[model samples]
Target: MVFMNYSTSTWILILGPLAVFLVITVWVIELLAKAPPWYPAIPIVIGFAVVFLALGVLIRAKLGKIVF
Candidate 1:
């Protein structure tokens, strides 16, 4: 019998929901500080997310295939 050091299932279930909740909470707090008509804050949030995600993908792709 062997024991695993870490459980990927725990992270897949727990951390996934936790990460979503944290992002939503931060976005709501930011939007509340901005003003009324919550619509505007949405675009800003989405745009920032998209740009960051794209940058991450680009960086990962470059790193995955490197020749020196």
Candidate 2:
């Protein structure tokens, strides 16, 4: 049986989510500060959310399984 590294797994999860959250928050804030209520930034926000989610999935996959 292979022993997994819990510390590495934790860091991977934390860093990926943190980075994605920060980026999305910044983007939305910027758009809101500039665009009007009827602007098209809504779709762009959705697209970014999807991309960030996919990135999280990829990060988890790369981290593999953690047994501890």
Candidate 3:
């Protein structure tokens, strides 16, 4: 078995972008509910989530080494 070591800040760096993505997704849902748009929101949101998740992973991999 293998275990990963993580500190508070390290976890934050890894999850921050994902957290932001979740919050923004909620806001987008509200906006969509208030006024539906012609373009499909699903693809856009999916892409946004991908970007955020990638960024979080990148930050964790890079900054995690430097900071912690």
Per model, state how many residue pairs clash.
Answer: 0, 0, 0
Better of 1 and 2 by TM-score: 2
- Candidate 2 residue lDDT tens string, 6-34: 57766666567767786876777677758
Instruction: State candidate 3's TM-score.
Output: 0.58
Per-residue lDDT for 1-68 in model 1, tens only? Answer: 12133367643543465467558757775876678777567667667666765675565446523421
Per-model TM against the reference? 0.40, 0.42, 0.58
**lDDT against true structure, model 2:** 0.66
- Candidate 3 lDDT, 1-68, residue by residue in tens: 11167767766766776788788877776676666562367667768777877887786677666766
Distance (Å) between predicted and true CA of 48, model 3?
A: 2.1
Residue pairs that clash (backbone atoms under 3 angstroms), model 2: none
Model 3 — which ten-residue stretch has the worst lDDT?
1-10
lDDT values, one for every candidate:
0.57, 0.66, 0.70
Ranking under lDDT, best-scoring first? 3, 2, 1
Best model number under TM-score: 3
